[model samples]
Target: MSRNVILYIAMSMDGYIARKNGDVDWLEGDGSEPDADIGYDEFYGSIDTVIMGRKTYDQILTFGEYPYKGTRGYVYTSEKRDNNEDVEFTDENVEDLIGKLKKEDGKDIWLIGGAGVIDEFIKKNLIDEYFISVIPCVLGGGIALFKDNNPEIKLKLLKTEAVNGIAMLHYAKR
Candidate 1:
């Protein structure tokens, strides 16, 4: 099967993935239900590899335990760091690296993010699909979804669903 690169992420209605300080407290749901994953398990199960930005990796470290242990994880970073047996850090060109990965056998690649990595992939036209969950609240000011001066890229809406106040918008490159 052809490998697909998917951008699966959640953001506020105002289009900010997290607060200006990289805080994602707004992403947590109120205790209306004790164990609501909102299709996360299904999405995670479908992807075999994950690529994320360095800042995103740092934030994940603060989450107590590493989350993508089961998946082939790569962190895009220019600086050298201690080798992680579970995750690989690379400074290689994004376009070249992703092109090589796509040709290999895999279920799908998950483009987990911070704005910089998302913008780079979009610029290189590497992303195949996007699954954005627009949370109900809006952040007045923070990191925008696509960075400033991004190239024009069109998308075809594949599907949409409203799950517990969150608008899950799925789209494919057009």
Candidate 2:
């Protein structure tokens, strides 16, 4: 089976993934349903690998416990540092790495966030699908989901749903 790269992330209504200071505290909702994960569990189950940028990896580390313990995780970074046994750090060319992964035998890959990594993958047209959850708030200034120099790409809406004030959008490359 061919592997695919899916960009699954959440961003504010104004397109910011996090505040200017890299704070994502605004992702939290106010007194919302306890099970506000939307379709995260299902989406997580569909992927066998997760790739994210250094900053995103650092943020996940602050969560106390590793959230992606069961999956193969990779952090794209050039800095030399120690990481969890379950995670691998690489400064390899993103396109080449992703191409190799896509040819290997495994489930789809999940492209986790932090604008730099996402922008790199987007520039190469490596993402096959997008599962974006648009939160109900707007951040006036911050890192955007798509950076300023991104190439224009079109997507076909596969599905869309609203739950607990979040709009979940699923799209496929057109």
Candidate 3:
């Protein structure tokens, strides 16, 4: 059996997932630097599949000319989308999605997100762990990942890494 349902996201210090208008240049360091965070690379390599909301998938599409390698990624959405080798779009709710995923023989299932998707999984008690990268900057106003958290949640710290003024906090649900 495979371990399941992990969420991976990089958030600004003030808890915003992106800037007010959805810009993230600040987290990228200077204009010409490459995102060479080894920890994140290693983590992504471990996952066999990726699942994300339609908006997040679209946002990823807007960046980079090449394809996302290794894993097959699924976009969670109700509307039909053009099928591609890299992406599979589905509108199934999280529970149904997870149930269907559990039947597939795979390694870690990654929830690449919009805050709403992550919040929905957490609220449904379906998320297994949270791998959060805390970028060292604050966005006064923007999209937040925990905006609808109704219950206080606790995390068991698994490890920490400091790179590019970012704190990679690995927390498992307690």
Candidate 4:
């Protein structure tokens, strides 16, 4: 059976994943190489598909290297455009896209993104699990990591650890 959507992200105490302009240079330098790899590799290896928003896709593009291999990525957007043949950008309804993904034989789905994208998914109650690492630092305001409409989310904490002045929390929706 294919797994559902999983949100794997790193955030600050102030809830900003990056600066207002999408600059995460500080995060790039502060992360522990082994811990980062362990967390990322674990999530990526389990996910069969990844769904991201346009802004998140653009941010990843700026990095100049695609980390997605063997797994399919679908970018949800209201506008129509071409973003490489590898990435599929669709303006279709969210449920439709999710339904399509459910039919495919694969591992879990990854919900990688900026706040807006994550919010949409959270609001729709589509995210099944959230793997969050809280790093040290307060970026006051930028973009929130996870902002939902008081959706009554109950998280069953599965793991915890401190790496480089940070605390990682792995939770599944219950």
What are the lDDT figures for the candidates, one per model? 0.88, 0.88, 0.77, 0.78
RMSD (Å) per prediction: 1.6, 1.5, 2.7, 2.3
Q: Residue 8 lDDT in model 3?
A: 86
- Candidate 1 on 16-101: residue-level lDDT in tens? 99999999989854445537658899988899899999999999999989988878988998889865866899878998888889
- Per-residue CA lDDT of model 2 for 1-174, tens digit only, reads 888899999999999999988999988543466566688889888999999999999898898888889899899998997767778898889988987898889999999987999999999999999999898898898999987777888999999988878888999999
User: TM-score of predicted model 2?
Assistant: 0.94
* Residue 33 lDDT, candidate 1, scale 0-100: 50
Error of 1 at 147 (Å): 1.2
Give per-residue CA lDDT, model 3, range 1-174, as digits (tens): 866788888888889887766666666432232565537668777788888888777778789752566687778877878878888887777798788888988888888888777778888888778888887777788888786655666778888877766778888878
lDDT for predicted candidate 3 compared with the true structure: 0.77
Q: List the residue pairs that clash in candidate 2.
A: none
Model 1 stretches astray by more than 4 angstroms: 29-37
Question: On a 0 to 100 scale, what is the lDDT of residue 27 in model 3?
Answer: 64
What global local distance difference test value does model 4 have?
A: 0.78
Give the Cα error of residue 124 in candidate 4, in Å.
Answer: 0.9
Model 1 residue 17 distance off true place after TM-score fit, in angstroms: 0.5
Residues 1-174 of candidate 4: C-alpha lDDT, one tens digit per residue: 856888888887888898888887656325555444435666677877888888888888788887785668888787888867568887777777777788878789888886777887787877888888887778888777867464777889889877666678889888
Q: Candidate 2, which segments miss by more than 4 Å at Cα?
A: 29-37
Error of 4 at 161 (Å): 1.7
lDDT of 2 at 21: 86
Point to the candidate with the largest lDDT: 2
